[model samples]
Target: MDNYLTKTSETERPEFKIPDFIENMGPEQIHERMMASLPEDIDKMPGGFPFDYTMPTAAIASELVHYHLVRGLMAAFPEYAWGDWLDLHAKQAHLSRKPANKAAGSLTFIGKPGTVIPKGSMFCTAATAAGSSIDFLTDEEVVIEEEGRATAAITAFEAGKKGNVSQGTIVLAVRPISGLTSVTNLEAVTGGAEEETDDALYRRIQMEHSMQSFSYIGNDNDYIRWAKEVPGVGDCIVMPAWNGPGTVKLVLVDQNGEPANEKIIQDVYSHIVSEEDRSKRLLPTACSQLTVTAAAGLSISYICTGLIYDKDTTTLEQAAAEFERAVQQVYSEARESGTLIYNKVRSLITDLPGIVDFETFLINGEEKNIVLSKEEYPVTETVSFR
Candidate 1:
């Protein structure tokens, strides 16, 4: 608990140390305690007959001391626990590790006419450096037109962070071939997500209670809470009666507040509608129509100005970066679509050090509140400081 910011345990104490008196304790000390509680002449036919190796009591005491030492040590750290504690937590919340997903995008192959590029043709981002290039395989065999460009679907050889590349990033071929010279990625290769991390698992375990389903009133909070139970659903909104009676609309964003991909949307939709899906712990009431979709994305461009102090190590650039990060973290926590209060942003600026006066604070070029619809969340685009 000392270093709470990152849950660090640098100066933690060792739990398994033997007590000083017990570690140095000898047979003589054990005999003394026994003698004090016993009769003076209970068994004194021979020399030290009551407290000898023949009695076996000394050996029993040693065993008990060892038990205490081992138990204390095990209590010191979570790793010492026989099983993975976090794994247990994940099981309770049904939070399983998601496998790495390959980012899917379009690949363009430009070559001579009628060139038959076989299916599973290899291409990468670079020529010489194989690792530097993100490899892709043609999804289907495409025959090129006469001296024209043909696009193919290239699946990454392996799935991981390597495939989460930017748009137009992978342009080079892994090895050159006749009639296949240039290659380009037409769109961003998104949907590539790494395996679920321990931190992510632990966070969800902490929310098991809040995410528990109620008696299926199917109200706004019920829909939102249950919708987020699906993996990769970062945040969600519930619009009750959006399409008149017995209809509800749900909008979801990915864990990073981006639009949910096709796969994610389908997963959410199945969980909400189907009775046999993994997350369909309890099906919704009959006769209620449900619509699951991705929320509209919007960015909040703002300018923050503050006075500079002479001794401050932080520059305006650094402060602006910090302010922008704050907006993303704070605003996304709730993500309730509606009016974004201008005063909340101004209050955030007031707390920053050396900002004696907030000269100009604007959200999307407005000094006052900026209202957003039910399907929008604020994106952290730019934060400028003067």
Candidate 2:
């Protein structure tokens, strides 16, 4: 597995600053406007709300807007139009936070199997920034209850902290853009009418999920092709962990406000279970990243027969080995079929023997495989044919 790494330096790159929640404003004034976004109760409540719950910093607010904005961009504009933005922004914006003394951002990515990342590609992380302070009110008790009625009113201040950041970066330098699809489209399918048999409904659901997954990938490819023509953009890259691609980090230089304060966006990956677990055959995992959830996608492993029947009475270990080999061969072919494929890379066999030799199979000729086996093989004892 030969691999190379690429890093975008701030010195060489142009200004990619995430503009302050408000451009060219002093903190005092910006603070005043930010207070307006707060709930009215803070004014009424003696002890105001906490910062996290009450006031959102300019950077924090901007992040909310930026993520939705990008999503809107991806949704509203054609892939070509969206690509134009991505390409232009990658150069003009920071891939990560600005370097020391340098007012620009950069990012690094490790190229993986079958792909080589190119230079000047744009990758971006989108999400809310963390660690902002909100003007809140807190109650201070005074000894004189009635005489003083003295409740020392304190500004209920809540400090901003990063929540589980789930935003993934788009790296357009490793693989062609066509390879990456926003899984946001593969939504769950509704179950069929009551009259439909379980088999028919299950089949329909599986097929729909597969089709939607394929469609997402198809759209992503289109997105990449469109991005290629944009100025200042380079080739796109797709990563294994499917938050889209690349290793870019988006940081909030300052919260949106007149005098925006510096705050960081909490990392989102920790909260999301990576698609890596979706590949296991026995362990059923949901594809949260995929827009669709009702059924397994193209490279899914589905249950067929719950019993492992080896007429020769082969040992479970032997049967399992052979089954695994067969499945591996199938996966190789599935990868070449040019269809959307989803496989969970991380899975553990936990369930006990439910159905003997019940084997799992990959649907739609996808590049996924499974195996089953029995515990014993019988020797020929001149048995009579039935």
Candidate 3:
């Protein structure tokens, strides 16, 4: 794979390289291409046998080509060719995908004496909104143990923001129980994360290239990048000297793009402290006032209206619902690891379907480019569409 991209013949185009998409093509299509690979002078010369459309010769040739093509693409492509580009680009910095994690929370069971809530028992929220409700399974057995109540940790089967819910929301068991009376979540569920998506990872790898190595305790870029590289962290902000000289304040939001809670703040604080103690921090600051804090929340509201087209019978209410979905999609996309771009939201609304004209668009009751700090997010507090 080392010289995979090198031309089969040096006398050919010196810069010749395979199309990046070639690696992703299926075998059947590659075989078709091979079967059609007759010489330009083929028609001029008599052939012992014409190209065989129903034979394995073309497929066999394509299989070999496919193997080398894939390895060559992985070795030579700028995106995947780690050693020459990513690793060497940022002083040997390598981009790694943050693995997905399951959502976890505590579930309480109230049952009669000698009752047992075995592990893997399922429970969900009372609300029936699809995609909004979460289902969780207990992590272990919870015997009443002579008491009428017990608590056990539970986790969602899938990793995502859908698993995040407030305390006391999970009040129903998925299946009926002989002795169990009721179920409820004791604490708000958090820490569910999907694997780093291709888009997000590409952005991070590109960002690393722009981040120059720091001398001494690094600046805002250094701190922000370091914090974001953490396994569960999604985004970060650094406030240099927030508490006076040699003091730094850091804010982190979870992978869901929500502000860091006490637990997340403490985790970040502990990580920074350990890294600084070991002098592995980006800039190795001498100050110990490196504090971590959760970001402040800002609620936003939206009121939208658009006229139905002349030929369309879609009600205004239906149009409103459609608009709401479109707008939410915009927020959901960037809610994981980046700030919402106001212009992008506006653009998406303009593109919503069944709208003749946009009547009113508001964010926090104003119309402007609403830029958010790295630690801040635009929350949907209210929406009314007509």
After TM-score superposition, the amount by which residue 18's alpha carbon in candidate 2 deviates from its true location, in angstroms, is: 4.1
List model 3 lDDT by residue over 1-386, tens digit each: 24544532111123345666556456556545655676766542223244444246656656666666666555443354434343333334455666675667788888887888889999998766464557899989988757788898888777766777889899988889889998898778876777765435545656666764332446776677667666556667677778798888887766764565554565566666675466644446467578888766557677765643434756556655555545544554454446566667666554555556666677666776555655565556667665
Relative to the unseen true structure, what is the C-alpha lDDT of residue 162 in candidate 3, on a scale of 0 to 100?
74
**Stretches of candidate 3 above 4 Å error?**
1-48, 51-75, 78-92, 102-158, 172-188, 212-216, 275-283, 307-344, 351-359, 369-375, 382-386
Worst 10 residues of 3 by lDDT: 7-16
State which candidate has the highest TM-score.
1
Deviation of model 3 at 61, angstroms: 8.2
Clashes of each: 4, 58, 3
User: In lDDT terms, how accurate is model 3?
Assistant: 0.64
lDDT over C-alpha atoms for residue 295 of model 1? 78
TM-score of each: 0.60, 0.14, 0.59
Decide which is better by lDDT, 1 or 2.
Answer: 1
**Candidate 1 per-residue lDDT over residues 1-386, each given as its tens digit:** 11111221211222333456566344445655666666776763336766563336755675565555544454333323222554664565665545555655677778887877778877777634555557887778888877588877666777755776767778876667688767788776655566555544444444554657244666666666566666666677778788987788888776555666555676777876775754654446753688888778787788865555434656677667656645544555436647667887777665554555557788888888766678887666677888
